[model samples]
Target: MYELKTKETDDSVIEFIERVENLKKREDAYRLLDIFTETTGHEAKMWGPSIIGFGSYHYVYKTGHEGEAPLVGFSPRKAKISLYFATGDPEREQLLESFGKHTSGKACVYINKVLDIDVEVLKDLIRQSVTFLQELYPKEQR
Candidate 1:
């Protein structure tokens, strides 16, 4: 297992938020983090270099790909904030339609600012995504 180097990491989650050049973006990120953890009943951890992640699931596909990953996470990218979902369910695509100003990658939703989206709506989306993952994968496998 790879240990988290929290102390030595300059971009620790807290410090990263503090460094956000935009105030609204910073506040929104923090709010989403709180809501995501509460709704999913999971704690958040810093994944890889910058993603703030909550919950985790282990996945092995028919192609022989297998790995454990966060069920939900976000990166405060330079151009926009990117929300990640490992599963690309159709319902999630529908959610993005009404999710306010955003664009989508295969499994990432990109948002420029929190003000561009409804906070409550975002929370609901997160809840739905986690629920979808749990249903698709067994508890042990997830």
Candidate 2:
């Protein structure tokens, strides 16, 4: 069986943010914590050693691999802040057009800071990601 390395842990989300060595990144982490919490209406949780996640959902792949994952989350890494969202949400591409400065991968969006993006658009992305994941892996199925 394959183990999920980034499962939720009983770590302190605040302490993790406080420990971010970069002052700017630390401040951005705090701002993101507030924004994600307010938008998701869910408290933050430590996901593995780094990620600060909100609500969670269980996902089972077609291959029978399954795991729990946060509906949305972010990590203030050394290079940039990585925002986690649903990978298959079509609206994500559309919204990112107006999202200010950011780069993205299949499942994560990278931003330097909150001030560089439109916060309203950020909120929309957060809501869409949560809705997308929740619908894909419905709570009743979890």
Candidate 3:
């Protein structure tokens, strides 16, 4: 059995954000906190040590792996801020076209700071991700 490392913890989201060494990154973390909470309509929670997550869902893959994960989240890292969103949505890719100054991997979008991206597009991405995930795993979302 594989263990999921990113399980939600009782850690303080504000403490984690306050520990961010960079002043701008720290500020952006606060901004992102507000954005994710307001957009998801869920209070922020700490998913692991660093990730500030909002909302959650349980997902079971065809391979029998299942776990709970955030509908949306972000981590203000040393290199760049990592934005977590649902993967495999074509609409997400389309929104990224206008998202500005960000690089994305399979499941995360990395940005230097909040000012580097369009906040409206970020909001749309958050909205679309929540909708897509909730619809994809309707019974599992809470």
Query: How many steric clashes between backbone atoms does each model show?
Result: 0, 0, 0
- What lDDT tens digits, residue by residue, belong to model 2 across residues 78-122? 999999999987899999999999999988999998899999999
Order of quality (lDDT): 2, 3, 1
Error of 1 at 70 (Å): 0.5
Better of 1 and 3 by TM-score: 3
Give per-residue lDDT, candidate 2, residue 109: 97
Q: What lDDT would each prediction earn against the true structure?
A: 0.76, 0.95, 0.93
TM, every model: 0.82, 0.98, 0.97
Instruction: Give the per-residue lDDT of model 1 (tens digit) for 76-123.
Output: 777899998755677777777788998888878899978889777788
Which regions in candidate 2 have their CA more than 4 angstroms from the true location? none
Of the two candidates 1 and 2, the one with more favorable TM-score, higher being better, is 2
Worst 10 residues of 1 by lDDT: 2-11
Best-performing candidate as measured by lDDT: 2
